[model samples]
Target: MNLTLRARRIAAIVLLGVAVTVTLLGVLLMIAAGTEDAAIEGHTGRADADVVSVTAGRTLVRFHTPDGGEHLPSVGVLYPDQLEEGQVVRVEYDTRNPDLVRVAGRGATLTILPVVTTLLAVWAVVSALVWWLRKPGPLHLRKLRPRRIAV
Candidate 1:
């Protein structure tokens, strides 16, 4: 096979591999992000997240979840969000520990998975097809031999 063509084939394979790698990394990141302590099971809890105050780093949101029975949550510094005094929004909190809070339906981090897997699957199939198409020409060349000139 020609060196340039072989290099192209190798490059295509490498690109496919990179796509798979990135997809795997995204999956791992999602798993790590969802990790919570045994004491608190993060579950769906209906609560109000008021637009308290948007701060420098994160928007501080406040919401009340099912406490030991109910009542109110202690208003304090919540990281990742600067909250306003009052703004209504939906939120999810840990059932066991109401303190652990996160925005509902924001677990879309794994959404890139389908796109990455699709790209890799397409590349692998196309790579095989292209290599097969180019293979016949080389074989035909091998079949040809030096011929004597009829003088």
Candidate 2:
């Protein structure tokens, strides 16, 4: 095989690897969200939490338990969309582990869209790149041919 063909093969392999990695991450994300939801369902607690801060990844909240003890989940609340700092919002948490908290009425289902879309986007891009790399082209063939000269 020529250098171009070998290079294309390598690139396709790399893109396939990236797709596999992304798919695995998406699956893991779904599993984690499901697990957290399960934990909250098993031993549920309700509280009105004060949104301390909101970042792209997490929303920090401080809430008081039934016993009047204050708790703030270090990793922040799950499914905390549309919340702003200093806002009060209802939250559900694992009574046994108060640190495990999420926005009330929101569950693992909320994660499905983002994960599925991300996987679809990654696969689409990777498939296109791999196809472009592997597909045979007239231009590519022409480039491999030797130049002709008239004496």
RMSD of 2: 5.4
lDDT by residue for model 2 over 36-127, one digit each (tens)? 99999999999999999999988999999999899999999999989999999999999999999999999999999999999999999999
Question: What is the TM-score of candidate 2?
Answer: 0.88
Where model 2 places Cα greater than 4 Å from the true spot, the runs are 137-151
Best-matching candidate per lDDT: 2
Number of clashes recorded per candidate: 18, 0
Off by over 4 Å in 1: 33-47, 52-60, 63-87, 94-100, 104-151
Distance from true location, Cα of 112 in model 2, Å: 0.5
**lDDT per residue (tens digit) for residues 21-46 in model 1:** 76677666555554632222335465
Model 2 Cα shift for residue 123 (angstroms): 0.9
Worst 10 residues of 2 by lDDT: 136-145
RMSD of each: 9.5, 5.4
Backbone clashes in candidate 2 total: 0
